[model samples]
Target: MVFGFLKKRRREEIRAQPFPAEWLAIIERNVPMYARLSEADRDELLRRVLVFVDEKNFEGAGGLEMTDEVRVTIAAQACILLLRLDDDDYYPALKSIVVYPAAYTVPRKESEGGIVREDDAVHLGESWGHGAVVLSWTSARRGAADPRDGKNVILHEFAHQLDQEDGAADGTPELDRLAFYAPWARVLSEHYLALRTAARTGRKTLLDQYGATNEAEFFAVASECFFERPVQLRTRHPELYDELARYYGQDPAEGSASA
Candidate 1:
């Protein structure tokens, strides 16, 4: 009971702050899906965003200056994933968000059966197991601007954070019920294999071919497609889409005509 009261008090305190008009304008102009939410969901999202901005540290990288626009933009997208979630402990492990001015190059290591190769590669975003998410500001803004492209770096990275909540990024997040895990594993495994085949055969698929790289990447890329291309995902991969819809508790396609 004490914990519940504290949580409620914290939420009330966060919600008591005035949501900036400019931030609301940013959401209105940038996040297309924000306009599709019902009034109640929108209010909830705003509350979550407020709490998220209060909790997470935002740091600028590569000569970028963190601003309210950047913070709120990223927070709103991250909170979108939490909108229908049951708990308010949004990303308990995520503590910091690092934003770069543009696509940043990072050192990469590849191992194929004990042969190791090192190189530098440009990436839009990355999520770390130790509770930090790195994103390219340009990609993040563009992703918010165009919501139906099925290529949201913010969603993709935050999905990785969710995948890591269980201390591993194995494509399966913590589920509400034990039984839900069985179907989640079954459906995602089937689709992951199909994506691998599609990637090898050079066949077009609803999900990004990057998903075929690994199970963890599959979940992240699938999450991007789930939110950004829901109707198409539902049409092409109904069972996989159903699993995601069940977990998220929101049918974005049903809410948006364009989706």
Candidate 2:
């Protein structure tokens, strides 16, 4: 109990700290969505970013150097997920962020017809259930730079973080109400199946086809489109869009309309 109290106190202090002007500049310059957020949401996001950066350790990998630019830029994007949550714990399971200068390779094993093939597979970012997120700096910057492209590595991996918080990465995060489970499952399942059918049929999709891999990836990909291409997501997949907007508590399509 004492430790918990102390940790809460420390976070309160961190939240009270004056947000650095340079950090705000970094968000303004790197995150296009920052400008689209309402003033109050912007303030909340900045506070979340402050606490997120303070709590999560960041390390450079592959001979890359970590800087305020990298940390703040990454933190801003990650914390965007926490905005408006009723009980935001700032990704309690996430302990560290490891960033490579560019895409990195990891060993992979693929089984085809009972034969397993081993090789190195390139990845832009990966979210682990064990409590770490690894990212490629180049992909992260590019995702942030062109928010409308409907791809954001930080958003994608961090959405995985949210999905894992419930001890599973099954497309459903910890919803604010138990009642949300039914619709969330129905809508996301329908969309996930649609995406799979679309992929098989080579139909164009608003969401990245990568989501068709699994429910977890579907959630992550949907989150990217939720924030980056809200208007289209709403128009093309309104049920899917409504589920995400309800879970996120942000109607990004409304923001786009007002913008």
Candidate 3:
């Protein structure tokens, strides 16, 4: 009760502060999906954005200085994932966001059966299960600037954060009820295998081919397509689209068509 009260008070304080005109302009100029939201949803998104920006620590990495534009842009897209949900926990497990100037490389080591391979792989963004999200500021800005491209580093990484909330990032987030799990598993598994088949067969698919890599990657990639190209997602993969709509509590198909 005390924590809820404190959170309510903090939300009130955040709402009481005036949203900067410059930030509004930046959102309008950069995020096309902002214009597609209904008036009430827009208000809710703004509220969530304010809370997200206030609660999370933004750290600079790779000589990238954190700015209001960087923070707000990243927060806005992340908050969109939570727009229809309740309880402003804001990915309680996530504590900080680290921003890089551009694509960054991290060393990787993996063992298969008995062999271990080591190499460095370039990444645009990554979400750690522990407490951090790392992103490339350049990729983030481009994703925000072109919301219709169906590729967003922020959305992809944050979707991983959501998936990790249940102590696993195995393509499933916390659903509304235990009963929903069966259907989620069925739909996701079927589509995931289909995507893998499409990838191997050189067939065109609506969801990103990268999704075929793994269940977790599939969820994140599907989320990007769900928000950015809902119409195409619905037209091509209606079952997957419906499942996402149920999970998100938002029908983005109309918004995408109108936009």
- Residue-pair clashes per prediction, in order, are 0, 0, 0
Q: Which candidate should be chosen as best, given TM-score against the real structure?
A: 2
**Model 2 lDDT tens row, 143-204:** 99998999999999999999999899899999988999999999999999999999999999
lDDT of each: 0.91, 0.94, 0.91
> Against the hidden reference, what TM-scores do the models get?
0.94, 0.97, 0.95
Candidate 3 segments whose C-alpha is farther than 4 A from its true place: 111-117
Taking the tens digit of each residue's C-alpha lDDT, what string does model 1 give over 118-227? 99999899999998999999999998888888999999999998889989889998888999999999999999999999899999988999999999999999999999
Q: How does model 1 fare in lDDT?
A: 0.91
The prediction achieving the highest lDDT against the true structure is 2
lDDT of the structure predicted as candidate 3:
0.91
Candidates 1 and 2: which is better by TM-score?
2
Report the lDDT of model 3 for residue 131. Answer: 96
